[model samples]
Target: MVFLKVAPMKGVMRFGKKGKLSLRFVGPFEILEKIGDLAYQVALPPALSGVHNVFHVSMLRKYILNISHILNYESLDLREDLTYEESPIKILEKPDKELKKKKITLVKVLGRSHAVKVAIWEHEDEMRAK
Candidate 1:
């Protein structure tokens, strides 16, 4: 099985709703056909109909079968537009740094899961304003 890695900026700009910016991947879609050595044609859902299904090999990743990686399907409230919201549940760290003459703070945010790998570092000002 294979899945696609959602480009951070693209995901946020295209599929993110206001106050939500945490969906890192979109699908485990089936591969319809192979396109040469570096591309593939995939079966995308209706919500993603506007986008082309043919993706570069670099954009796809092998899906590892793991019970823990399986999300509760019923809990996901996916919209017809393929957009969803996910807010950080906790702030794990605040690191201050002096860049040039200005002070900047980096915030480590924890998502719904406690897994440390899922924590995302964001600018303190941006995180606070949101």
Candidate 2:
């Protein structure tokens, strides 16, 4: 018998809520389809373990606000529908070589925008609560 481990996730966002918007994952858009004005399913990676939920709008804003930096494109004419994913869980408690190698990477994806830019930086110690 084979037993596959399942992930624990919670409702990060909901409809009819203030500051709520739409977002999608760069991948898995097929397995998790969006039905226009409906919703899109997201699969959290291992790094996002223990994460409960996130604000759809805030998540979108993070990408939108950093568009200039991420895409290096000057013009916003390319309003391509894209998705961004970030781990909501906390890491760094256990410093493993593999986990360190697989450290959380801040990624940004813009649709049809090849010039899009993605930046990754180390989090401040204060940023991580003890």
Candidate 3:
């Protein structure tokens, strides 16, 4: 297995927006065979079927086998909208923001909204309405 480097060349478009993008190596593709002196054919996913598979030896990196590479995917029980309902378990804190005209109250609500439950700040009036 190896990682193929992604770079910009003549007549090539970049993967990211304007500025220094962090797009680097793409994959841990299996090497099919050595094409010539310095090129090896790589097995790319269907998403990259339109791209060229052969890469230079300098653009390839040997991948060390790591247990962390294995993915443990857990299916989420989603609703029709693809979002699950999350109820606020507790109000962690209440803070007042002094605006020019009036003070706005915010409540720190703890909820299991995501896989990892996080605390979110919400308006006090909105929280009461819900």
Candidate 4:
């Protein structure tokens, strides 16, 4: 079993509106064949048929599945659309800046996962208005 490494921004967009902040690695997919010295063809699900199954070695990580350990580990429930729902936990910081005649207020949000180092910033006024 191997895990696929997806870009953080792309993964967030694909996961959901709020994004599955903790769900970085999406699969433990089986390797179909070796494409080259640095790449391998993987067996992807039908939902990901549009994406090429071949992936570079750097994008894959080995998954060690232990039956006893699996009981304590929670797997993400991927939807039919290959997305999961999540939300921001709180606002870590609120800062304001003056740009000419307008003032923009930005809020640094803490997402569901503690592993997220980069905070998601949103326009406070826009978010509040919405």
Candidate 5:
């Protein structure tokens, strides 16, 4: 199995989110056959059917299995729109970030389940409005 390196073309597909948080690679796709000296055809999902299946070796990363992957398996409840929402159960911290120009007040919101935990920093004023 190998992960496909995503082509960073602007205004194209973002596997998950936009901006710097976008997905860099997708899948541990199976290699169907060797296409040439440096390329191989991969079995990509139906969602990626529009894309060419064949890829160069340099664009693929080998997947190495280990204990951590199995032990930490947690499913994200992604919606049909590919967005996942976890309501903030509590505010963990009130951190102040200082920039060269000014100071920004932030509140750290904690979202957690029995297995999965997520934290996000939000503007203190915006969070209060919400």
Candidate 6:
């Protein structure tokens, strides 16, 4: 559910083990922009995959559900409020010159909340480097 007054939240998540693929979001989510069915720029975790990375079954389902739930739940303050763009079904691997410098080909999401952002960490090295 959406909070009228932004709630405190934080954390990070990585799509891979090496911390090569990632997205970060700091929340105190103040409804950035809202369209009919899509909420663009709503506060989300850091390290959100675009739509190209290969994900494991469990990881994929979890991330999709988490985003879905957040978008589906009603807002506490607003009458009818749900925020989300789309499910993370296809996580694409992007090349980060910064990460490549560290000899790391991974992405990481960092913030404050762990339980909320855990699903993003599904694609680990052992399961993905195939």
What are the models' TM-scores?
0.44, 0.18, 0.55, 0.47, 0.52, 0.17
Q: The CA-based lDDT of model 5 is what? A: 0.85
Per-residue CA lDDT of model 2 for 3-97, tens digit only, reads 11222235555222222342332211112333345333344456555653222322321122333434444444433565433323333333323
lDDT of 6 by residue, 9-113 (tens): 344444322233333322233334544443333444345334322222222111222545454333233234553332233344533445434643443323223
Tens digit per residue, CA lDDT, model 1, 1-130: 5787776653346455422565567677899999999999999989988889899988898777788776553355668997665668899999898889999999999865322236888999888888
Question: Which regions in candidate 5 have their CA more than 4 angstroms from the true location?
Answer: 10-13, 71-130
RMSD of each: 11.8, 20.9, 4.5, 12.1, 8.0, 21.9
lDDT per residue (tens digit) for residues 56-126 in model 4: 99999998987754434345666899876545677899989889898988998766542333468888976
lDDT of each: 0.77, 0.33, 0.83, 0.77, 0.85, 0.33
Model 1 accuracy (lDDT, Cα)? 0.77
Model 2 residue 120 CA deviation in Å:
24
Model 3 CA deviation exceeding 4 Å by range? 9-22, 30-41, 49-54, 61-77, 80-83, 89-92
Error of 1 at 33 (Å): 1.1
Q: Candidate 3, residue 9: CA error in Å?
A: 5.0
Off by over 4 Å in 4: 10-12, 17-22, 69-130
Error of 1 at 88 (Å): 29
Could you tell which candidate, 1 or 3, scores higher by TM-score? 3
Q: TM-score of model 3 relative to the true fold?
A: 0.55
Q: Give the alpha carbon lDDT tens digit for every residue of 6-122 in model 5.
A: 867666658767766778888889999998799999999999999999989999999887667765646878889987766678999997999999999999998765456788888
lDDT value, residue 83 of candidate 1: 64
Tell me the lDDT of model 5 at 27.
Answer: 87
| Best model per TM-score | 3
Could you tell me which residue pairs clash in candidate 5? none
